[model samples]
Target: MRILRTALLVALVVGVSVSALAKADAPLIDAVRSGDVSVVRALLDQGADVEGAAADGSTALQWAVHEGRAALVELLLGAGADVTATNRYGVGPASLAAENGNASILERLLDAGVDPDTTMPGGETLLMTAARTGEPDTVRVLLARGADPNVREELRGQTALMWAAANDNAAAIHVLAEQGAHLHARTDNPSRSPGRTFSSTPATGFTPLLFAVRGGHLDAARVLLDAGADVNDAVSDGQSGLVVAAANANWEMAAYLLDRGADPTHAGAGWNALHQTVRTRRMNVGFGTPGPFAAGTLDSIDLVRQLLARGVDVNARMTRNGIRDGQRNRFNRLGATAFMLAAKVTDVETMRVLLEAGADPLIPTADGTTPLMVAAGLAIWNPGEDGGTLSGQEDEVLEAVRICLELGNDVNAANYRGETALHGAGFRGANIVVDYLVEHGADLTALTEDG
Candidate 1:
């Protein structure tokens, strides 16, 4: 049986002529590497596998296509190279050609039966990949070649349009939209599985609207909004696009959403935008970013003022995380009045804004921490020359102390630690603030366990 099998192999080799078959075997590799049309033609004439691959899993046609050798690519295709043949990682010849900017080669491969919708390991389709490069022409070619505009990868839930939108690829987005891509399709599954967290979701779990608002594509957000995409669709942790827009300081987008009835007061937002801005600024802590919050131009303090003007609770306490037994939609234990938040940041404008809007400075916190206590503590804890206004630092601290007095705060008010604002100033060596506190009837004799 071994002898018979050997004889059959010998006969097959002889039938094709050993030299001719040997030449056919490696000819495609040589032709692509050399970009030579005649060698490619000879190999095809001798019945070589026109799609023969190198050790790395790239085919002869892939090499020719990637090199932009139009003639060799044509010859290989005519020899029946499988255009859709994927590399080890599933990147097809058309994708390889697209990667190298060989559009002509891409066209030839597509014409030779490459599937434009072929996906990579993570379910990233060719169109999604192309959109990531921000190449409008490649995107247009793929769309025109019948790639489904709304096709989504199962793992990531990313559509081609989503990729374009997330990358801020305006032209590609325009082309994909014109080609009928579904803008509303979620690019990532927010509720899929524990394995598919917001961090793990494909393309950031961002919808077209979230991408638009976060990426500063106000125009795109407007377009999507007009097309009937829900303005209030919350994805991760119940954070809506409006929330992202507000968090990012993209005022135009926020205003746009607000105008379209997007509630500035979103679920899971510990406080409204205005209150958050005030608290973050006063504490010298940003909402998420670093530095004193500038309350950038896009912030709708005006809108907040308007809400307050209409009698929305200016002194409302936000349900923050540090609070205890907080009922849903009700003030939590750590909830700070608008005035408390304002005093912490020492933004005179914010203070003025809240006060004008009817926030009562007299309200004391659960721990007996008043707005004055918060301001004095912030002034002491916040370090450096830029901590606050140097010239009026003492006066500002003193003024808060005086305001508390006027508002009927206890003359010797103490906090959970039994520390008054005076203790904070004296321990920190803030002579000016301490002097002001003492002169304004702060209890010099008050002593906590630390004192």
Candidate 2:
């Protein structure tokens, strides 16, 4: 009878203790979530496990950091919470705190001997994540905590400073550089090239400054340049910083890079920076659809001047034969030289800028079309005769022709088909252009082989 009573009492005591522990677990997490510090302290004193993970495999520390509860985070850390604990997404406390710019929480975690360079599953360290966040505070704090600024991510092998430049975060860039981040580290991601990133067209690899220029972040680009980034670094596709800037028509960055001694004449895949800027100038508006007018015309002209000042050949032709008249909408692909590209622009100011900078007006493309012929054809172009900008286009074309003539381009230059400017002007019975061509010294009797 004594043994039975003793066994029964011990079993009851064990059951009550298990019940208390079970009761303590639920409220601890609840307290942390509700930001009830007192309740959390009480549960901790009552023998609740500090590392109790929630359903998402995240502990109270993860919750506190994610909720941006700095005070709660401190309390939890003091209670022996694991600073390196991550949620289901592999996002750890340090990454969360860095993203939130929670400096105090970060400091606490670091002081507790948590590695400042702790990264997620994708190899995104605290510094890389914070750099792209555009807030420099977290970046600075992490650097002070001994985060490696030169550490690369898994996918692109890009460093923290490169991520900042890629996202156009100037403030973050400033902070990272102040702590000795590398400026010219190149990406080594194979997936970025040869359609490996899940598409047919390949991607361009980048340096930190290349990303800044590609993103059109003028201030960020300037910062990178000042940090001794190489202006002439090229991608796997051989595109330099100046070339990318010109390709995006980022005239401001282009000009600044040019001033910083970036090569203006550097060509990639047969297209030079000068030729790319002119290509942008030459893209025509769609028929009968109003489009945003091309902006930064004056900036473009200034960029051209900078290129000329750099001693780029005023008549540098492409290294490869042009792609012309394909189903890819390649027509009048006079992408051969800056002057010929100016002819395709049909803008008087662009033509004037090129001519003033010593771009020859009479240069014929491989197809033998001249600025005079291109102007005459565009002047009489009637987009269904009902397009709203028809009058403006006609005026522009006429002005383009006048500018070409004033620049002394040959009036009688013919193409590979033996077709003169009149042939282009009189195409599809465009008599307005034919009459204009006739008045401007184009011979009417000139004919192609078929004619």
Candidate 3:
């Protein structure tokens, strides 16, 4: 009984002692976190440990640096606070200072022997971080302190200029360029083996200008172009800035590139800018949301006009089955033309535009699937979707079908699989298209190769 009572007494004493220690530590940390310089100094005078860490392993100096409190940082440093203390994320005072664009705090950290080019866990450098922050002064400080402007990160082999361009930091781009950053440097492109096909993921082989263009940063792109960037530079798959702009529905950027001497006829491995523009327009506006055309839609139309005026082939065809959302499907898009893409989505206005521009309606896919057949629901381009049609778009699709037939298309044309428009209409349960095809002399007894 006496021993049990002694053990309880010791437990009570230990608990009180730990509580007292926590009380002593909390005030200093709270003072530092709140940027209360006087209170932090008072706590230091009261013999608080300078190296005491918060719950996340952030020391007083690190917190001061993170808070951008230069005076507090100086005080902590004078009190012998550890500058190298890191938090749970491996972020130290220097990293916080660099990311916050606090040049003074970063300078102090550097004066305390921190490397100006300190890298994150992923090998991203301080210059890259500052460049992404869009603060030119922070980037300049890092560069002046010996950070490499052209240093490539290990992950993507991207430089500080690439980071700046990607984040739309025009000032940082200017600074990096003035400091001799390689304006034409390309990111690492993974080597493709022979006979091995790659998806169009935009994963590699991007220049800083391509990054800017892909991000839709017109200002950044302008800065890059002014810096003598090649407007026709392409990725590994041969997609130029103009093609990327068209694919992303960034018609403004596309127009800008065209104005700056971008090649309108540049064809990537998959599709040209025209095909991408049609496909992306469908994805953006959807099948039939009834409203006035948006400003972006108008811009896209204008861009299409510009491409046509620049001698872009209105009858251009896709060279390969480009990247799609679902790759497991049996949909093959090779030899598809812009007019065919417009018909597939039942885009009546776009179809009109293409037709007026002399887009051939008789062009077919590799399997001989014609634009008229596609308009009659003859193919499943993206399976599990309603053949790219919406609830209120039956009339528009029927109009597209009418336009195709009026263009002298053969209604009884069969693909390689012996499937006609009637087969596709029946498979899709498109009663409107089926009735129209029957009235237009579509063969009712026509059977597929399977039949």
Highest lDDT scorer: 3
C-alpha lDDT of all candidate models, in order:
0.60, 0.67, 0.75
TM-score per prediction, in order, is: 0.67, 0.72, 0.87
- For residues 22-132, write the lDDT of model 3, one tens digit per residue: 644667767877889999999999899998865545567876776689999999999988777765556678877877889888888888888887876556778887887
- Predicted candidate 2 versus true structure: per-residue lDDT over 177-278, tens digit per residue: 888888877777776441111011124467888778776777888888787788887766666777667655677778878878888778665657777666
The pairs that clash in candidate 1 are 282-344, 282-345
What's the lDDT for candidate 3? Answer: 0.75
| Candidate rank order under TM-score | 3, 2, 1
Give the lowest summed-lDDT range of ten residues in model 3: 191-200
Per-residue CA lDDT of model 1 for 166-285, tens digit only, reads 666777777787778776676455444312111111233467767676655665666666666678865554556665554444556666777776765654545554554343333332
The runs of at least 3 residues in candidate 3 whose Cα sits more than 4 Å from the true structure, single-residue gaps closed, are 1-24, 189-199, 284-298, 325-329, 381-392
lDDT of 1 at 66: 62
Question: What is the Cα-based TM-score of model 3?
Answer: 0.87
